[model samples]
Every structure is written in C-alpha cells, then in structure tokens.
Target: MDGTSQSQPQPPEQTPTSLSPSAQLDLAITLALHNWPVLSLAVQSSWGGPTSADKRDWLCAAIAELFTDRPDTDAGDLEEVLLQVMNDEFDVVVDDESAGDVADRIIDLKGKIDKGDLEMVNKLWEDWKQREGKASSVGLFKRVETNDEDQETDEDEEEDGEDEDVEMEDAPATRPPREVIEPEVDEDGFTKVVGRRKR
Candidate 1:
C-alpha cells in the first residue's frame, strides 16, 4: 500500500513500445500523415511518457486520435508500410503468442473502433490480406479468410493457361531443317566452325 501513490492511479502494465516492432513503425508512419502536426502537438502536450512503454502507447493513441479527426483522408498506408518493413526484418519462425491475450486486446480496441478511432490498425489489416494473397487477410487479433473472389480469379487464370497450352499445341510447327547435307565439310578434315553455325 505504501508503494501506491494516493493521488494518481497506477499505470497499465509495461508493454513493449508499440507492443511489437511492426507496431512501432506503423505508429510513426501514421503520424506523418496530413493532420500529423496537429495530432503530434496534442500527443506531445498531453501524453506523459516517463517510460519507453508509455511513449509507444502514446504514439498509437495519437494516430488513433488523428484518424478520429480525419477518417476519410486516412488511407492506412502507413500501417501497411510498417508491417511490410517488419516482415522483411523479422522471420515468423514462431507463432507462440497467446490467443486469449490477443482476443482481450482486440476487445479493448472495440471501444475505440466504435469511436472511429482505429484507422492505421484497420488499414494494416487490408495490407495484410493483399500481401498474404490466396491465404486471405487478417486483422490485428482477427484471422480473416482470403475470400473466394481470389480463388475464382485463380481458377480463371488456370483456364487461361489451359487455353494457351491448346493454342501452342494447335499452332503449326514453324521450325524446320532437323537435318542438312553438310556442304562437303568445306574441303577440310575438320568441319567449318563458321557460316550459319548450325543455328
């Protein structure tokens, strides 16, 4: 009880700045958007980051703040770029993170989502889908199935490939001259190394 500050509430548990490296990049990139100057001022002025963990949470909160203010203009590219950067840097050799923890966190974001306060995070999801291709897309804590539209598109591609194969088989053979009468070996003991070169 003595450790507790009487006037101030205890801060949340210290998570990594941005929770993960990718999240860090996403937050920074998202802040650079148009409303960034205004948003940055707000975050810097209000958010007290005595610890590194607090700094990240603050950054994310700032971006969410901007998104809330300017939803239409927010394309979510910042999140995608950061995620791409993260993937290139880190290998996904393990999937050992806890699902329950993930779900809990996603639930926590729901209130923000309701407030139109989740932009880059949502954009990150779209980018994830496009990058994963046939495997489909996923959200933060959300596992999305890559829809049948892509599958149907793939099937169309296979059909086109089949048509191409048929066209190739049906086309007449333009190649000719499998054999030729060597022009008397150019009067030497060795065959001529030049002249058309058996092309």
Candidate 2:
C-alpha cells in the first residue's frame, strides 16, 4: 500500500434520539427551508423564537388550537407532515384529493364552498358569498345579538340614568349620629368581640 493520502475528520454521529430539542428543531427547519415563509413568526408581531422549529411547532399548534378540524393538528401530525415533506424533497404534496379538504379544515367557509362531486370547481364570489350572508368576518367573530339578560341590564341602566337626570341632582344628606353596639364582657375580665354594628 502506498499510504500517500491522509483522511479528514468527519462530523460526529447524530442519531435521532441523541438529538437535543434544539438540534431536532434545527433538523425540522432545515427540512422545510425551501417552502413558504415560516408562518409562525409572521403570524403575530409578538412572536419571537430561539429556532425555526419553535416557530414551526407553534404554528401547527396555533392552527390546531384556533381551528381543530382542518388537519389532525397534533404536533405528531405536524411532525409527520413536515418530515414527509422533507423526505419528498420539499415538493408540494396534497394528501387529500383536492385543495378543498385543506381549505375546509382551516378556512371554514372555504371548505363549505368546495364542490360535492370533486369535478366541479367552485366560484369564489358567487356561490360562497351568498352562503356567508352579511357576516363580513365570515363567522370568525360572529355578531351575536344581545341576549335577554344583557338587554334587560342595559335597559335598566339607561332607565336608571334617565330617572336620575329627571330627579333632584344631589342626593339628600342624612344625619351621621348613630353609635355602634357595646363591647362584650368576659369572665376573665378581658373584653371580647361579640359582633360589629354600623355607625
């Protein structure tokens, strides 16, 4: 053997379980780097992160927390999807037959709008709009009409104000001359508290 060449040192072995939380997170992000903006950070200005995985994990959790039906939404599901995307080399892969399955889960109205036959494409403005009605926010924050109790309370407060406005502006003064109750006496000669009275 010639023994002319020297070998270079290699990166330390990185088994999946041996990965720290941060390293696992790094692997997750590296896996998804080519896709759309990591939405977790852009979703809210208040969001900041130690790594991409935190944002990704939070993003999936937030989506599930906000809208549970879209995907299974468990972190494990997100992990599986993300890793699947990575294994597929970041090509867009839609598990459901159509985009509507995804739209239905996350965008409540969009799912409702999807065609039943799967052959028909839905029109965004015509069919979907009438179904949504006057709900500008599309049921995210519904405009609930005042309930009976709230209506009654509001009416009482308004009437109370109107009555006060029509009557004497100042409340009548009362005498503050009343005395409190006498203290209790004990056999040991120490005064004990019986009860309190208002002056």
Candidate 3:
C-alpha cells in the first residue's frame, strides 16, 4: 500500500465581509469590551460570579440592542450603560473613567458600520485574534506576586495603600433593585427610551 497524505477540509473563516451589519456591531462591541482593562480584570478575577464570561457576552447583546433600538445612540448613553452594568452585575464601581473610552470606541465602530465601512472592525478582529492566540499560548491571566516593600511609595502611603487594598466585596444584602424602563417608540420608529437602571 502506498502512503499518501490527504488534507482535511477546513471550516469556513469568518471574515468582515461575511458578517451582517448587526453582527459586525456585535463583534466590534465584544472586541471593545475585551480590550477594556477594567472589564478584563473583572472577568479574570471573577468579579461577576463564576459566570463572569457569560455576563460579558450578555453585555455585548445588551449594548447591541441599544443600537438597534436607537441609531442615534451616543457615547454618553453607552458610557452610562457600561458604568451601570459594571456596578450592578460585577458589583464594581469603575471610577477610573475608562468606560467612557470604551463607549466612544463602540459608538465610532457603530457609525462606521452604518456607513458600510468595516475596516476598523476587521482590524479589531485581527487584534483580538492575535491577543487570544498569545493568551492561550502563555497564560494571560496569571496573578503576580509583589512584596510589601515594593508597593511602598514616596507619596501619601495611606492613600496609596487604601486604593491598592480595595478588594471585591459581596454585594449588599439590601441594594436598590434595578428598574427596567420600557422603550417608547416615536412616529419615526426610533425608541425614545434608553435602557438605564435607577440607582
């Protein structure tokens, strides 16, 4: 018997051209979220419970829904959504203001998608793939050990210590419940309501 190698059929690669506008927006949102250090830290640390990964996916859907409901959705609205979700779902208060940047990137990508420009989406997808490949090869979320002396600074030690010592505590037993605002569609068929939770 002659030894001959046969190549196996490969699965179809998902390119930017293959995705619909909605799917492109969803992928853009996911890439933006993953690139955010705060959200990445939260997921890596399991801040949103054991299903933190699922929560991130849910966030992508929620953000996509906002765009579907209102094409004119801006960064301010998206920032509020990011902040609210971080506070409620992950019990994390993102005071660093990085959420605004993430929101802006998402909105920009959305606008590009609306205009049928998928270049940025394709770039982000490539970046994500490269990052994921590296993360898989070498553990991306490995915890680092630092000595107490190394943490000490010349500035206000107390303030620095306080900030660094902050840990993720369990959510309050009696916290205000989130109120879901119903969408109010106008004559133009655009939703006047932005999904926001009352603090």
lDDT of 1 by residue, 75-143 (tens): 343344223322322211212332223323433344444454555455544454455542332132221
Q: Report the number of the highest-TM-score candidate.
A: 3
Model 2: colliding residue pairs? 70-105, 104-111
Ranking by lDDT: 3, 1, 2
TM-score of each: 0.19, 0.19, 0.64
Give the per-residue lDDT of model 2 (tens digit) for 23-57.
Answer: 22222222222123333222233222233344444
**Residue 4, model 2, lDDT:** 86
Off by over 4 Å in 2: 1-3, 22-199
**Per-prediction tally of clashes:** 1, 2, 0
Worst 10 residues of 3 by lDDT: 140-149
TM-score of structure candidate 2? 0.19
Local distance difference test scores for all models:
0.35, 0.34, 0.71
